[model samples]
Target: MALTNPAFSTNPAFKENGQAQTAATLSAENLQQMYEAPSATSVQTDRMTVEDTIVKTAICFAFLLAGAVVGWIVPALALPAALVGFVLALVNIFKKKPSAPLILAYSAVQGVFVGGISFVFEAQWQSIVIQAVIGTLAVVGVTLALFASGKIRASKKATKIFLIAMFGYLAYSLVNVILMWTGVTGGTFGLSSDVRIFGIPLGVVIGIVVVLLGAYSLVLDFDAIKQGVANRAPRIYGWSGAFGIMVTVIWLYLEILRLLAIARD
Candidate 1:
């Protein structure tokens, strides 16, 4: 017969001698009313929610766009921005708790890198930026639609595969960079551009696979957000969701841009 409602259990009115007062004296009607009362909402409880996460994500993107403008105007800052952003990304990923300022800062720096790279690519291939943007949007839109429709879902097995693929891609990228720096390969994209398979550039084939991996990574991000909401996580954690989405989307866009550039070559 003790007060069972969490909202009232801690109230002094419901406590007697530092212990919860038994509701034995209360009428059955009162107990029924209390039981039937509406529960607290996510906002009232300060919990994570889909709408809040979306708003946070949008804010991060706004910062990104603003930084991108500066990067476009001064392409020289691209390399430095990329290095700083990478460090920030690692910090954010490894930190136990989410920090809004750090996450937003990472977004801004990443935007600079994105803008600088886009400018470089555009200078070489006219309209390629638009093409990459369209391609990225298409992939994101389709992936989101599939997720919302329950056609795509994250599974342990698939995530394991994704991690393996990501590691492989990273290793290959590192080797390619080394080769480029050492002048082992002449093309802009190193092996990706220099090698060919059945008259098709190796980059085109690898790019297609990487694009699919990026899409699946998006799926994982969506699933994580959904889980966070379901678990009623703290509201501040929404920034983590925003950060994850931004990282995935930016990676996806850059991959698409590179793919288009290689294909055009």
Candidate 2:
């Protein structure tokens, strides 16, 4: 959000675990006097720390869950909640300083949108929401685990591939929506049910691709947080990092649910 985290800006090796890359003048030892430490300017940043990002992300999700629950129960409040959430997202992205209250408010509204949509989707899909929730958790958990274990890391080539896949999926969705709107088919699915690539359902194909995109998005989000912490950005900006991650996760969950439903129907 800050045109990439400061760690990325300052350090070439920002992607790896986001640990501080710059050499510290004073080690955690008695070799150097604490009082005569060099100025902050002398300290260079290399990457954002993971611990702080986790803490901030946890706080942000709490707010998101609260908002989602409210929105789920109050049908009439859904649209307004989405509007409010959008505004807050923009504010968080643009504001130089993060406000905890504002970020929490955003979470509330986003939660409402999630809940309301979940309610509608569940009504049609029947227990599909649970499946989606579980799937979402699985993906996030797996991704995080792999990342922590150094099994998966973001790369420029992979990122370019992700973007290409995303564009292809979006185009397919647009065409499908158009076909459905024109009453070309009177069924639950559009191109999803009819189209097949290599004997697999088109929807399934697209879903997998999109899910991958969402997963990669998490990588980027984590990278940003890692960068932020490395740069020792204002603690408040931690909220910004949290919000970004939350948004990506939610999107990922929704997409997973939708894909699963497509499979079921």
Candidate 3:
């Protein structure tokens, strides 16, 4: 039961052989200690677990929050941070093994980018950052609740559609960016603002759709983590789960932020 998310799919740690690999490296003394131990936790056994993954995710977010505070104070670092974040994200995603330091670096860099952008948005629209935060939290909370209740799930058919939509959205976004850079479109959001569908700004509609995609991405992240746990992946692989969730949540937040900005305009 492999997941679609590149973070999990490309990593061999989520495979059934993950635990065997860990065991192979253990010394006789370590095995004896484990056998003599009254009870061993997931950490003691060096196996992936949901609780450990949650803790790792929290630690990553904490670093992100700290970096965001710095970015909020100095928004000029936004562009550089974004560039660094993108590179780090690519590195973390394709790396054969999960690296906590690299993942944390990516999260921190992305936080700076997020904070810098939020500050810029807030300058034009008062309190927009807080509104975006609330909206993001609401969406995440509801999505998590539904997923926990088994009301929502990731399926092959839905994931295939998601990938298709992702490609289309990327293409549209690239075109929009080029138009804005070349001065072909005018406004803060380029085509999203200049174009209108049924008297509604094109950005507003696209934002809603993209937000849904982001939400689905979250579902995929959650499913991937669940698979990793079930597979008894190495404890270190928990960082991969955290990284995946962070990526999706940041994406979701940005989409919601842009959507709100377009609506306000």
Candidate 4:
């Protein structure tokens, strides 16, 4: 079988053998129990399943929340946390196979950066963090529901548009960052604050666009998980799906927080 999915392609469990395994022989009664098994599970067989993915995602989230609490208490760690998290994100993306330790580490480090930045934003604008959290959850819930209902899907055309928009947004961000570093704009948000279109802060516009991209990213993640399950991917591959979802959700939350801050400004 052709292993196209990156997660499964690197896994050895999916490899097939022409010769049958010579394990301990089973009798007819043992075979009968096999047919009578209650249900298939990740532990029972190395195949992927929705329940396994959910469990993996929950574990990652637990580590993330724990790390967030630590970072919340020490807001000064935000900068370093962001730097480390970026490096880890790149590492995880390029890895041939999923590593539970690495994925969990990424989640914890990212959570630190998220918590620290959230604390900073909350200090500047009261109640902004709560609002952003709610907005993030709402977007994720709606996107998941739409996907589950078959109202939304990943298509080549929409994916092309998403890539184009992502590139444009990246270019704008690079320019904005350079301008700010050189002290060209003195405002808190640099170009986003100084530039206005239709009496709205440019950041608000960009933030809205990025938020939409993040939501679509979640949809893509869901699609990937669905495909993996259908393809009978290795159970461990669920971590990849969980990691992708966490990254997109974090991006969405940050964008929502920025948009709310700009609006309140």
What CA RMSD would candidate 3 show? 4.8
lDDT of 1 by residue, 118-216 (tens): 999999999998999899989999999999999999887887898889999999999999999999999989999999999899999999999999999
lDDT of 3 by residue, 103-154 (tens): 9999899989998988999999888899999998998899999999999999
In candidate 3, list every pair of residues with a backbone clash. none
lDDT of 4 by residue, 5-89 (tens): 4666566665653786543587788878978989866988877788898899999989888888878999888899999999998
TM-score of each: 0.85, 0.77, 0.88, 0.90
Instruction: Give Cα distance to truth, residue 44, candidate 2, Å.
Output: 19
Backbone clash pairs in model 1 (N, Cα, C under 3 Å; residues 3+ apart or in different chains), count: 0
Q: Lowest-lDDT window of 10 residues in candidate 2?
A: 39-48
Best by TM-score: 4
**Candidate 4: clashing pairs of residues:** none
Residue pairs clashing in model 2 are 47-230, 48-226, 48-230, 67-108, 67-111, 67-112, 68-111, 68-112, 71-112
Clashes of each: 0, 9, 0, 0
* Top lDDT hit: 3
CA deviation > 4 Å runs, candidate 4: 1-5, 9-35
For residue 24, model 2's alpha carbon misses the true position, in angstroms, by 15
Model 3 spans with C-alpha error above 4 angstroms: 1-39
Name the lDDT value of residue 66 in candidate 1.
89
